[model samples]
Target: MPKIRQVEIKSCRLETYSSKICVPLPAQNLPELLSVAQKLKELTPDLIEWRADYFSASDPKEIIAALEKLRAVIGDLPLIFTYRDYAEGGFVNLNLELRAAIIESVLKTGLIDLVDLEWQTKVQVREQLLQVARENKVSVILSYHDFQQTPANESIINILKAQQEAGADLAKIAVMPQQRYDVLRFMETVLYFNTHYAEIPVVAISMSPLGMISRMAGSLFGSAITFAVYGKESAPGQIPIEKLRPLLNLMSSP
Candidate 1:
């Protein structure tokens, strides 16, 4: 087995062998954004993920300013900057180069703790952005999202291994499961990879209401971080942070 890695952000430590909660900020405007941040602060999530693709402003400067404001409100909490591509459940469709540029710009701001990069980005472009992220010391979460259906366990393991090979600090896979067995398969894949393959942290979830249990039970299977929603969910089947926090605590207790 590979050596397990641990990521420290603020007061929390995300061990490759452990689990934590991350809340997604899906607001589209300044007031709504700040409101979500303040409310999430009260809930005390382990990390804050700003789904930048959801914001109305497309300008890089405006996005940076908004992130700065978010940093002020969430003080010391880790922030994840994500500009998801529309092909993978995000709201907007931009030119691939434009999307890559936006991510590079966000990394330049130096305000975020991590950045989510899609695993499907072209190798040349992806490498360039990864280089920029490395220079800035920003951790990358190379992710794959399947909004329609879950793939076989072997395929999922390949995806995680690909992320590890690409030098991602964490690997995340989210799939929409059509049945209960798919959820189990997804968790099993997570367990297999974290136990037998790469040591990088993994965030695995099966989406939609049918896969809700995986979100709460992922920790048991070696998923390091799970996403929760405050108001609007960035992805399907995300539990509200308020409810998820207590449930996780209850489930984790002896």
Candidate 2:
């Protein structure tokens, strides 16, 4: 298998790789965000993702204020700031310049531990954002989502490779599954990529109920992170962090 990079972030004891459980905090506005943040503090997720696209605030300053509040509440837990794209199931289809401006503003605050940037973002825009993230020392996750159906094996592997080549700290790919076999296929593709060519850790998911097994057992297949929910799932197939912890522990043991 390709070796893990062994990078460490002191805030959350996060390594460059391994099966770390992450729960998405999907509150719509500042007040509700604080409520969910408090609830998440009592949970055991290794990482927390603030799904900013679900948030209703439009002004960049308000968004940054919300992030600052979230950081204060979460303490040292690693935080992922993600304003998912509308095409990839985000709440709104913000125009390119507006989206970049907001994300860049958040990065400048230096509160977020990681930022999820879509792979399909316009080339110049994506590169500029990547540079901003680097300047702030915020790790980048270049992500691709196929909400419709999982692509062929070659295509899946290709996307992962491209992400690593493009300079992602962690490469993530999430695809939908129509049949039971698609779940296995998705996991197998991740396994092949990690064992053969991966230089960076990967977050692989087979979205929806059919792919839930991948969330529980994906550590074995080389997925470095899994997304779960405390109460509401940010994605279609996410289960509760309470249940995911026990299951993940069981599967990871000797």
lDDT per residue for candidate 2 within 89-115, as digits (tens), equals 898888888988999999999898899
Q: What range of 10 consecutive residues in model 1 has the weakest lDDT sum?
A: 10-19
Pairs that clash in candidate 1 = none
Native-to-model Cα distance after best TM-score fit, residue 9 in candidate 1, in Å = 1.9
TM-score of each: 0.96, 0.96
RMSD of 1: 1.2
lDDT of 1 at 4: 77
| Model 1 TM-score, 2 decimals | 0.96
Off by over 4 Å in 2: 11-17
Worst 10 residues of 2 by lDDT: 8-17
Residue 66 displacement in candidate 1 (angstroms): 1.2
